[model samples]
Target chain A: MTTTTTEQTPVRGGSFEERRRRVEAAAYRIRHSALNMGEVQGQGYVGQALGAADMFAAVYADQLTYRPEDPHWEGRDRFLLSTGHYAIGHYAALAEAGIIPEAELETYGSDDSRLPMSGMSTYTPGMEISGGSLGHGLTIAVGMALGLRHRNSASRVINFLSDGELDEGSTWEAAMGAHHHQLGNLTALVDINALQADGRTDSVLRTEPVADKWAACGWHVQRVEGNDVGALLSAFDAVAAEAGLEGRPAVILCDTRIGRGVPLLETREKAHFMRIEEHEWQICREQLTNGYEGEGK
Target chain B: MTAAPTTPRLKTSAMIASFADPGQKTTPAPFGHALVKAARENENIVGLTADLGKYTDMHVFAQAFPERFFQMGMAEQLLFGAAAGMAETGLVPFASTYSVFAARRAYDFLCLDIAEPNLNVNIVGGLPGLTTGYGPSHQATEDMAIFRGMPNLTIVDPCDSVDIEQAVPQLAASDGPTYLRLLRGNVPTVLDEYDYSFELGKAKVLRGGADVVFVSSGLMTMRALDAAKELARHSVDVAVVHTPTIKPFDAATVLGEVDTDRLVITLENHTEVGGLFETVASAVVRAGLGKRIVPIALPDAFLDAGALPTLHERYGLSTARIVARTLAELG
Candidate 1:
């Protein structure tokens, strides 16, 4: 019998390292673009976009498998943005992926642009589902996961939902549906920034012990510091391992801060739509540039 | 009633399709048959019910595809929400429950998730209007009016078994989302006059008369046809347009049929406001048709229910009542 050698193992050194660096740079570009686009639009939900940058970085960089040239490739992994207001963040990621032109990022929330404040699946490419109303995306994610399972494909479905959305009754229903179906290929990334438009989520509906809730719902839950690249990668690896086990769906409760890197915006009570002073643009741009350089490969 | 040896309805040149020659079945059985067949054709097609699969005749689909069928266990709100999710994944889901529960209990989910985004889910409602003996809780007299206001939803209230049979494949074949009011199990064979070549959005004109036009939809079309036969006894000629697609009404066809002086009667098995009657009346006025339009529909109230036949007459929706109302308005 011919022995298969260890040489068949795909090495994770040269191109993979370069891809990681490129993705980090892409994440920086997305954050830079989102901040600028939010400014141009007069106002937007920039805090959520700012906080989700690093988590977005790792998925696009090393975890997800897709060819940017063909956004609709059947074999590509699907990314569903459940919180519609965070189209600001999703648009940045799609632009980084070359699904949309980078220049189009400036047109967010504009009258004629395909990029609306809340995402509409019909108008935009790579927008897997229409989501504006809270607690809607998980159900669609369950459906897509079931579809992939039916097709017998390994392509994973990732649904990004906000902590604020967890208050919705439908979200829990979707959580019940996903685990009951035994969708091992599904992964839910909860952007737990602890802030809604009104106030902090704890002050609002208070989804205390969120991880416990997901655990009780039968999902294999993992808590991660969302902004750390190492933590994100580790969480993804664990999720992949669980998928290999073929037992249950997974949720990564990503702890993050609202207005993550920007000092002035971070201190604001309502970071949803940060209105920067004309002179403060330099400060925001400087912070993003420095943060990108420190994380640059 | 026994069939006469010599036909009174029509003396056909072709061999008469006998009603009693040991070959005829008065009730339409094709609705239950097609649902089971459709389930076998597509494995992705899932069946959902809120404690009502057998009563609605969706048990046929359930029996054929047990693995895909999900009995939502009396939670109608979750029933629609889950079905909407299933539709998002490219699955063709047929959700069946009572018309009232869907129209009232789960209106929010139906409007927000399924209708607003336009997911391709099929809603099959059983005992539409006054089709059941069960009282106010079961009688969905105002279902059509309730769903008519929701945008991006295609509403099809099939009159009989033929429409139900044809609607299953047609709704599955169509791209956008739809809500079909079902008349399941021993459904009356009302629209057998046509071979059931029904289109999704187009109205089918069943009879021709220039004197009076009866624009009706759903089960009320059966009453309209019966009334047409009765009105002809007094030499008061009438035309009947059986329109099933209520949302995107065939306004042009309805306006064209009603002459400037001829009276138009709009009938339905739902509340007068926001139902088919108001829908047709609005279209007639908008199309610049100056014909006098009268609405014959259930009043805006919780309907008291008995047997379907009794309730239909009690609420002035019967054939005799329709004829009397038409003559009273026209006379």
Candidate 2:
């Protein structure tokens, strides 16, 4: 609800236990909202929503600075969602941040709804770039970072990407570009969930040693368990500690499962996208609620 | 296909600078010089290129404003993506690449990132149509045709150094995204002779004729004017109309020129199916002009790798070929 000063994130003032607990609770709500939206569509990228929930929460709830009422505020930190299909989770995160109303979650994927099936800036408030096509986010972030530095703005850019985008040559090009520009204001958070369309990520394409690849591209790299709120928060903290306007850009590669918390969906073979039966929606929510222990609302 | 008896047999490298004819008035890097002047006027303007600063004439702006110039390696997608990103942060980015790369390779990036958002990113594309002799890979023969489908993009096909210089200030001042088919590096100054003034989306009638009218754009406009002059010596009066802005075409001016029962011809450097030919013919058909339209355009095929002047003549876009096509259609 308050703005984070340039020196410290909103979570920095809180104790580690307190900060992690708040982020975990937000992640739980984010995952819960994602499941509800998925039921509306009958099938969607719900696996991605559940998988990348903690990372989104760490961004909106703890790391990023934005005014919900003023989503277009020039001073606010930017969160670019590059993989546009992750709107199920992104809508939840936006709702969680109060950038959009939580009640709007029910309108997800419906005609005339602000929340569409994919991320589009034309429809939603607080959605910076219209994304769906892969490998486009990081390059835009590089430009935004440079623009901000040119204007001498203290705002940071946090671009969200998926591991599937690593296969896109444009992503590597942007990685090289950001380092060439030495944009410390840019921070890329990659959701490394190993499931993509046509099968597991490895089978589709071998993108292992992603950290090394990013490092070779001249980025400050850190690979962590994406589902852990604490690890994710620490990565942001470490990045924040050394970031300057003229320095190497940072990338935190978070390895995550397709379906993170819900036991019923986690083991599902069709995990790239999920099609939970009407009755199974309740069970998935129950699994999420039961798995959550961050002082439930 | 056999080479025409009239077509020149010059060696490849000798005619690469075919656009800059000997002793003709010209300006070097009009696009670059104009952009530098624009950047000087507006502090928010920035220049970007995909390792094509030299080719696209963006290097002039780069040299003028090195801090604002960004060379995005040999990556077209990154160039556009970064331009859109910079636009979002309130900077006007003039991004350049070969038209083949911008129109075909990075169409999606242009569509979603710049056009969909309606950002202020100017796309200056070099080697449009048959300007290059580097075969299909470099020549952007279908640049305008491909960009015609994209909404909110203003497509400009400049005729000469004067056109590029004038269009630069206007393109930079306009709010939304635009695609400029750049005439770079020692471009001709033919339009200055007609007392021409470049308007954003308006067409100009260079000269009046009673026998035939040539509605053209790009370098084809230059050929039409030359052909019109040649046709006068043959006792035939030919009208020349230059429509540089191809997307929001000056259909009214073009259709006005086609009102007479004289033979109608559409001249362009692009294929006959799309570009200015199709635009003029489609408008004529829709307006019930009932005129039989003749086309003087490049064949809808992969063109050969050779000297520029020879390729132009072989494809019926050279001045002599235009005069020949006009007389045949008239007969």
True contacts kept of each: 0.30, 0.75
RMSD of candidate 2 to true structure, Å: 2.6
lDDT tens string, model 2, B1-331?
Answer: 6868585577555312556667878888888899989888999999999987887888888888999998899998899999999999999999998899999999989999999999999998888899878789987888888999899999898899889989999999999999998888889898988878999999999899998988889988888888899999999998889999987878899999998888888888888768888888888899998888888888889999888877887888888888887778778
lDDT of each: 0.77, 0.88
Q: Which residue pairs does candidate 1 place in steric collision?
A: none
Best by lDDT: 2
lDDT tens per residue, model 1, A11-125: 1224544655655666677788888888787678787888898777776656666656666666767788889888998889888766788888889998988999998777688
lDDT of 1 by residue, B6-96 (tens): 7343222111111111233346445557867776676667788878887777787777777777776666766787677667667887888
If you superpose only chain B onto the true chain B, what TM-score does each candidate give? Answer: 0.88, 0.95
DockQ, model 1, C-alpha based: 0.24
